[model samples]
Target: METVRTIDLLLDAFGRIPPLLADAVRGLDRAALLWRPEVDGRQGNSIGWLAWHLARQEDTQVAALVGGEEVWRAGGWHARSGVPYDEAAMGYGMTTDEVGRFDVTDGEVLIAYYDAVHARTVEVIARMSDADLARIVDRSWDPPVTAAVRLVSVVDDAAQHVGQAAYLRGLLGGPEAD
Candidate 1:
């Protein structure tokens, strides 16, 4: 595939996916939000947990990509000394099984929060010089991936999970699957 602008890729992913996923969960009643499908025999994460997890993962990985290595290295990021970080990390929480249980049940807030995070990521990428992009850094256990790799991984993970969330929503009788 031809190389594309990172900003283009990021925006495209966000624009195409979030709405569909959000729509999938829109109008869901409480039980629906907490609905768990038995896929191969196990209960899947609830919409609330999924949303919280997605936001946490994205915020953490994005911070890492931009040089904030320890932003979310531990569970403490979600604890007392960590509420601020956790709030930034997710926008949701771990205890809640589905989106309906979150402090902000409005899908719009979740969508907007994700957009803001993506915008910050883009800004960070833009600020990186070519050298910075090519520079290798150890951000995880699987050896060092370049700044570029981390950046792409962050976007890819977000998109993949958004799709997952949408799928879960569909399984729960969301609009997309109806």
Candidate 2:
């Protein structure tokens, strides 16, 4: 709820969950979790896929920033996640078929993975000084990215994805939201 300071802003942005993602995930059957709306013969992203992607993105980014192993691999989530293998795979450039192949049955697993990533991110940020936050961690851009910017990027990306997941959850109705 505190968004005044930089760290608080990141936490507030990431922890902002008015939509209640756990409600979108918990108690939902596999069919409901993986349902993608078919529109004009194109299938949209599923709630499960969005959550999985968000977790992967956050896990990879936070781990890289901290120079630590990804919670996905470290926590053995890669083995548990039924998706196909790619050491760097975080749902980026995944084909529609690949997205469809994401066969995570239990929502609890996704929730747990996300929770671990969130915890690690919080831990890392909590210990960082203002100088640490200002340190350049990425150099791909004209102006290198700082730890603070990177963390905000993670928060921004996660918010969009989780918001999409929530939207997909809302779209499920009739026999679908089962």
Candidate 3:
């Protein structure tokens, strides 16, 4: 049996995310999408915020790997969604107040942005060679981050956020995607 190349594996993993994300976002009413659960003085993220963060992180990371523009700004998502384009804030290290202030209540916008980022992710991987994947993208950590590592990190983050959104959807009794 032929072993799957790392590129193929990465493509397959990224391909699986959109449907899961769609299910998590679909049929969610404004209330469900924007609902922030709180327990013991800690606030939980809403489904909308999860989706938004996933897309933003993926967009930022993948763009960095490809040495290009993020889909969020290049694709005019920020303008279309009425959210300010903050290149520095890719939904990482956001304080509780900042998370609470994320006000994209429309599921359609959230899903659309995620879809756009997914498209860009696939394209970037398709255009990459083996050497590109092995190249170091960041050296901030003790172990410098490679393109392959960054891609995996992006997918891992997206999967976790997708699961959180789905859990929130189920708790709110949101309908399944049609």
Candidate 4:
């Protein structure tokens, strides 16, 4: 596919996430949002934590791609989220305990944070040229990562998490949860 078309597809995919997530958690109270299923005596991730993780990942990864400050800091999301974490915390490699500590009870704010990050992602991708997409962004892998690869990775991660959130909401027995 042409590079611009590819980016446009990515933008459309990314644009769908926030509303899907919003629908998934609609009518959920703070307690419901924080509910976790148990497997093997350990609590699974809650809807709140998953949503926060997705937002943080997108904010950090997109910021890196664009060579700009993260929306978490630049757009005041850290304070807006009222989550009591440092600006750079993106939920990667966190311990179970650390994951359990994510306590953003207000679903509206969480969705807003995701919206801001998604907007920045769309803005950045809209301006990218084919040459820009082909440039290597990370050299740590056996095959260096290109900007296109990184963006695709973000999309994949976001899709999985959002799907999981929707599934969990269904499991929680909310109306029209599916």
Which order, best to worst by TM-score? 4, 3, 2, 1
Candidate 4 regions exceeding 4 Å error are 1-4, 176-178
TM-score of each: 0.65, 0.89, 0.92, 0.92
Clashes of each: 2, 0, 0, 0
Hey, what RMSD does candidate 1 come out at? Answer: 6.0
lDDT for each candidate structure: 0.57, 0.81, 0.84, 0.84
The C-alpha RMSD of each candidate to the native structure, in angstroms, is 6.0, 2.8, 1.9, 2.1
- Model 1 CA lDDT for position 15: 55
- How does candidate 4 fare on TM-score? 0.92
Model 2: lowest-lDDT 10 consecutive positions: 15-24
Cα-lDDT of candidate 3? 0.84
lDDT of 4 by residue, 1-178 (tens): 6454877888888888978888876667888778888889998888988888898898889888888898889888777777756668888888788877777748788888888888889899999988999999999997999999999999899989989888889888846455
1-178, model 2: which lDDT tens digit per residue? Answer: 8446677767767676422556567777888878888889988888888888899999999999988999998888977766565657898888888888777848888887888888888888888888999999989986999999999888888888887887787787654343
Pairwise TM-score winner, candidates 1 and 2: 2
State how far residue 162 of model 2 sits from its true place (Å). 0.6
Off by over 4 Å in 1: 1-15, 68-106, 139-143, 174-178
Q: For residue 143, what is the lDDT in candidate 3?
A: 96
lDDT of 4: 0.84
